[model samples]
Target: MSADRVVQLRWEPRHVADDGRVELSYPGISVVSSRQGEVVDRKWVPVGEEPTFADDEALIAVLHAAWRWTRPAA
Candidate 1:
């Protein structure tokens, strides 16, 4: 069987605002993934409005799903 994969969002302590907005940092919001306890992918999230995602890439997909619970409907 293939190793179980996991996706995680990591950021610095003060880099994220109380409103869930991320400030400009060297490595903005980090989209990290690992399989079998080993890191396999890492990417920076593009700057955008809080609680909304425009990218459909695999990494960004996770963020989209998570934001659904936090943001109100338009």
Candidate 2:
């Protein structure tokens, strides 16, 4: 089996401009949409050494598996 790897994620709240535009995207990321109490949609944000994935669902699945695998015995 391949060696285990650690992942990290960093999130920073975006700043809104006086013209009602909020900057939700980072330098290499894209912000699809943002609304009050609805959702802050984004394309994808890079979290680690790997290149950013076009689809975040895959990343979410990997994280879910890691969480379950590393949990303490019940």
Root-mean-square deviation (CA) per prediction: 11.9, 12.6
What TM-score does each of the candidates earn?
0.41, 0.27
Index of the highest-lDDT prediction: 1
For each of the candidates, give the backbone clash count: 0, 0
Tens-place lDDT per residue, model 1, 1-74, is: 23355667887332445556755333346766666677767666554444344544644666665444234354
Q: Which runs in model 1 stand beyond 4 Å of their true positions?
A: 1-3, 12-27, 46-74
What is the C-alpha local distance difference test score of each model?
0.55, 0.42
Candidate 2 least-lDDT 10 residues? 1-10
Best candidate (score: TM-score): 1
Candidate 2, position 63, lDDT: 53
Candidate 1 structure lDDT: 0.55
